[model samples]
Target: MASYASKQLLSIAIIFFCALGHLTSAQIVTLEVKEGNSTCIKAELVARFSVAYNTTNGTRTVTFPFPGNATVGNRSSCGGTELPPLLAASFGDGHALILRFSINGSQYRVESLALEYNLNDSSIFPNSSSPSLVTVKTDSAGILAQINTTYRCESSWPVSLGGGSGNASGNASVTFSNMRLQAYMLGSDLSRNETVCTADQSVTTVAPKTSPVTPAPVPTVPGNPERGNYNVTNNNGTICLMAYMGLQLNLTYPSSVQNKTVQEVVNLQPNQTKSSGSCEVSNATLQLRDDRTNLTFSFTLNTTSNKYHLSGISITATWPDMKEPFSASNGSLDYLRGTLGRSYLCSAEQTLVVDQTFAINTFHLQVQPFGVNGGQFEAAEECQLDEDNMLIPIIVGAALAGLVLIVLIAYLIGRKRSHAGYQTI
Candidate 1:
């Protein structure tokens, strides 16, 4: 009886700890991508939804709880080397969500995302047909980032798909939030590594000193730039590079064009037209310009080994007192090195010093340097910063495992000693 009691206690302890661990982890569901009978990608996702529907007198909104156990249905276009890979999921009661992806050259993007919920199935809309649900595509919540990278950010931002159509028409008024996704996994099992996003970076939000009522002095160091997804596509609708960063350029140009040097800051961002960057099989470019400055970043593709990197940078600037715009070029620097169809990630700030004249800093940066395939980030090369960030969890997990092992060993020895004094009577 004593031995049996000890064994039972050991089992109970293990179960209790496991349950506690599960409760502490994020509420996410697992998804698998099968490629030719092999499970190529495994992911965990957490999605929540808010939807609007018609009523007898007016309209109403319903917010859904954390989506649990949503499965990718048969119509999903996974396991292909195609332009886009899609995941379609249908929850119970005719509620569904679909995610579309685009991969080109060196980047991947969320092409489209839609949420569907049947008004008839929802208890709030009692007198509706079974197929009365509408679908809404989010116009702004598209996540543009690298291919084959782990994306992590705890967001409460509401991403509206649309349907404010205001017409009594059966259009979807849908939104989603608290989205956590790890997709295009390199191995069958999902990895816990995460690439930092620009949204998670510190912003330069120092309000300008204006009113006399303001007491504190304004800060001199600028905060982070607004990070966003920037891409370029070819005339053939093929992608070249997909970059995500809050990009800022620092130039130490001669203040008088004769030799007195000082700092000049330029921001690189997407424009209204041709906002999607440009790409080719051999190389890609991201460009932004102002009235006096033109800046371009060039990435080179390695076809033989199927890899790519940020290889070159060029700028044209016309400062005051200078008659002609000065030109600067730097090539053969490997910044974000990554495999084709994969991404490169750096959580910490990165600086590329082209020369004393100019330097580039990228924050909250995750990029698919080249060779995006199947509209999915399937593999990744982590920057030293991200790798180091990932290591912390690993080290902590190892310590926890060691502690568990020690307790297990102690229990085993106790059980063995108890058994020594008795036989299988």
Candidate 2:
């Protein structure tokens, strides 16, 4: 009888040990971050975590938060669940959780696989201000075409379900990758939490449409011809294209895409150099023309010292139809036309650092080869100096002569009337 009783007690002890081992191992848990949405440039982060139980009695309290100092809440459907008056977070709350997490070395690393991210927090989260998106394409091998950073209007925090251990000896761990971030508006009524759970369900779609770029229109006068292809080059290997008339255009290197070229007919705006701002083309000057006569043309070039230099060049040619006033019309205006060539010559007097920038000092460039169309000349004939220019001086001389004749006629008439009266007496 004693031996039989001892066997029964030993059997019971072995069962108890097995049950304890199963209980300790049964509460395995894992957490995952499901990305939330938001719109603010610097956004708060919200994530969802799921806790699963391998055994029954799987109840556990969860304290999840949006990554930043954000408030937390639950969906309307989850009424009376863990999120009414959700967690109010402060910057330094000892228990306040933040979004930045890492998972290389922590206690419970092995049991993290059974858990997943919960999808319930969509209602509270705001859209992402800058959401990262990935695009994959297939070539010979699968390739990633592009990765875009997008902005979303809303996002939420992660929800954790089914796992935790109150014992300090038990381990807890997580891995943060293939992850996303979202934000939520803090502080909503507690009643809404329960309603949010069952309210609605739909597949989340990427946001559609972006603001389109509109190029400003430039009004043009019908009859007046204007200059096009305006360009400027400084010695610093930089060439800026000047917006002609009331327009602004952007300059860029060859290797860019999208808004790479900003050509708009915007109202002319002045970029005045400030006293403290470093100057580029110190004495920048401009020449204007209406692309017609290449001979005697109007040109203005100014230097950094506020001094102006000008030249009016022309070449003359004789045509069969030329006679009197018509002959002078054949004279062509001489002007400089080649690109300022992406080269700038600094003022010989000053020293410049290798890559440092300085202002434009001198602007006047002389048009060499002054005479006939021999080298840079557009016409073959000698510059007509006399005939076509005669009209202005001749007109002035004729006016003066006519004025003298009028005065003399009046004096003679007076004298003749006086002599006639005397002779009659």
Candidate 3:
């Protein structure tokens, strides 16, 4: 009975020591932030870790609390909290124990922030079994902490076991990790109004072609030149003007030349007029040139509501040594009528000349540097029949003369025949 009691006491002692050893081996893992040398008050702290163990083995688990606050900018302000319940394992390894936390919103600048956590192990073991070695090292290979900020700061630590193991017993170990902190200042304003002006100016010259004119009979007027009489001269000249985008201008001509009255005509070339959409020229000015006229124009951009006012348009005609200036004018600016686009005015003068018979002459004018932006100029002269139909009157007179001659001849012949037939009656 005495031997059995001694043996039972020894067995009790062995069991108590084994349990104590296991308790000592279990470890509490922790992460901490160290303050760095910086005066700015801005920093962020982040921590990540994983816990793994065997499930089938005699492994047990425990729940632990994570740290929240860290020292920043010489003050304890920035902090984080555990998202989920902290878990540990003893014997069997199953799913990974993932720990993730972040610390921010601390306006104060700090040198660095620290992190700390606990990892515990509880597992049953066979008698005289070797102690299991468990390690709590940085999850990422050779990387413990990462600091990403405007300032160049970092964390430092070596990977190793948190605590020593006990023979067939459980233990709790504490692990330490740290990161350095740095801070910076930030700032931001609005914009003003302005105006601008632009212009496009150009000049061009033109020479026109002429066609032969058919002559028509002239009417007799005692005191005036034959109404429809015109003599063709070799002095035919022409000028051609073309404006792709169109243009606006004003022209004037002399009312009379050398005491002879003159006439002016305005006509659009046949099949040459073109328009697109609702675009058309309105309120246009047309006149005969007797004196100088001024021309002004306002150009508008198609894509935007912008206008450009241009003036000082001068036209001069040069023939050998003769140079004559013509007058031009422009319309008032219409801010509201932006779609009017372009307009034009053209005029010419004519005079009657008497040498032996009557001849009509026209004053020649040339537009110097005759074109503007996308604009062209053309001029030509040809002998054309007068508006009056003098050819019809001439034909009627000839027919009447032929008829009168035939009647006279017939009367003479009839008188002769009667005299011959009467004999001495």
**Candidate 2 residue 289 C-alpha distance from true site, Å:** 72
Best by TM-score: 1
Each candidate's root-mean-square deviation in Å?
A: 20.6, 43.0, 52.0
Clashes of each: 18, 57, 79
Cα error, candidate 1, residue 345 (Å): 3.0
lDDT of 3 by residue, 274-393 (tens): 321111122221111212222222222223322111111222322122224433222221111111122221122222111111112222221211212233332321111111123335
* Predicted candidate 1 versus true structure: per-residue lDDT over 280-396, tens digit per residue: 678888876666667788888779656566777887878675445677777745456566778877666665645434666677887774666554455666654454345448756
Q: What is the alpha-carbon lDDT for the whole of candidate 2?
A: 0.23
TM-score of 1: 0.42
**Better model by lDDT, 1 or 3?**
1
- Candidate 2's residue-wise lDDT over 78-151, tens digit each? 11234221122222222222222111221001111222122222222123121121111111100000012112
After superposing candidate 1, which stretches have Cα over 4 Å from the reference? 1-220, 256-260, 264-278, 319-326, 373-379, 411-425
